[model samples]
Target: MVIPTTSISTDSLTSLASPSPTLDFYDSPEPAFSFLVQRIDSLLDCSSAQKTHHQRRLPSLTSFVRQVYVKCRLSPAILVIALIYIQRLQHELPIDSKGDYDTPHKVFLAAIILACKFNDDSKSRVQSIYQCVSVVYTNIDVNEMERSFLGVVNYDLYVDIKQLCQFIQEHPTLELNWED
Candidate 1:
């Protein structure tokens, strides 16, 4: 009896590594977006109250800051970095439908991941990004998310640092740089 051996080609491996879906499973807008925004606002109010009250404990202050950060979908440092990235992306890239890519959900996940990478001392790996995306979108496949991420970004366009600096200078009063 002769046994048949099959060899897996590079294309097959690449496909298996990053599976593309017929449609984005995580394309739906988060129903909780508004709720999250409200929650962040409430957290900020609480933090302000704490600041006003000298009796408030240090732990309470720390917790409030953490809660606000989590609710707002940001870290203090990452908020700045993400804003810079967005500003540069907007100036350098044309507003073409073809260039305008990624589902809102995917964009949110990418921003979070990018922010984490820029702000946090510890870097969030691709696996962590996959897990984050998976938690938010239960039905979406991780491989598909990774593939979609690569497809959405236009690497050819260099980020315009000067434009970003000007935008930052002009929008000095904007507290949260990347609200969306």
Candidate 2:
């Protein structure tokens, strides 16, 4: 059996080409972009009308995290270490106080040591960091702080630096690029 095939010429196809009505998607009666623009413009207009509106602004995630740490009576450095340690251990450490929580000298030391281990920097040494903490907290005894640091930290000195580096790499918002 023989099959017959029909093919249209390129010239004929070119001749049929004609400009049609150009309808922009954004020009629709209820365009999404237009709604967004209107909402933004409304917000801009209302922004100047009331001071309370500015106060209603949501706290940033970082600020919220810091607030959580503050509530736990943890210094910013300790909070940072806690976060890193938690990530490393894949578990939350008990916040039980063996003694008075008022002077968390041991916790401070532990945090500094943890940070140093994870960071692998000599700048955050236990003694120097403790000294800095002592200066900042004038009432606190440096010897006591050092003792508490040693006591709390004990043998758990090893920290996974690789994990910390990986976490930092993944979270660009952390801004961990510190220059010496």
Candidate 3:
């Protein structure tokens, strides 16, 4: 449950998190990754001060999630599951005339936390998972987010393996270049 001290440069972060723009999920990680990144980037106002804030600016959601995955030593399938959770949540709470209740970091972290619990053989403690996510979320925030996520998904944590396989088979690129 310890995070390594080695700092991952933002440049390296981009490479790690970069999914192909053409990525079709039928789709899985690609849609979720793009959705999260797009939501976050829209908030950054990156054009305001390009040079000064360039180095110290907060990392993109994609990069941060990549860091969490690496730091927590989570399997790639955790990400896939998290994305599925997100899709289900969207289905439950459609972003329409109703407000956007899903805060970017909280939702993303909660999805990953749930994914870990659902997919991992050795379950990760909430506190330990918080260690990797504390930069963007507090412990209480994580707790609330987990609750919110469970509510959104209707507490249905089970993933259908046949459906997942079919999805991968339908979208060969997701299976082939999942690392992207």
Sorted by TM-score (best first), the order is 3, 1, 2
Model 2, span 69-94: residue lDDT tens: 33332222233344444343222223
lDDT of 1 by residue, 1-180 (tens): 111111111111121122311111122112123322332232211222333222232233224333333444343333333444444344543444232112333333444455444333233343444544343344354345434543444432222334433553565443223221
lDDT digits (tens) for residues 43-159 of candidate 3: 322233224332234465577766666667554455555666766776676444232323555567888788766654334544567887665556887888899779877997676
Best-matching candidate per TM-score = 3
Q: Where does the lowest 10-residue lDDT sum fall in candidate 3? A: 7-16
Q: Locate the minimum summed-lDDT window of 10 residues in model 1.
A: 2-11
Question: Candidate 1: misplaced stretches above 4 Å?
Answer: 1-73, 92-94, 98-102, 124-133, 138-168, 176-180
Question: What C-alpha lDDT, on a 0 to 100 scale, does residue 54 get in candidate 2?
Answer: 24
- lDDT rank, highest first? 3, 1, 2
lDDT: which is higher, 1 or 3? 3
* Every model's TM-score: 0.37, 0.31, 0.61
Between candidates 2 and 3, the one scoring higher on TM-score is 3
RMSD of each: 18.4, 25.8, 10.5
Assess the local accuracy of residue 20 in candidate 3 as a C-alpha lDDT between 0 and 100: 23
Off by over 4 Å in 2: 1-83, 86-92, 95-109, 117-125, 135-154, 177-180
Local distance difference test values of all predictions, in order: 0.34, 0.33, 0.54
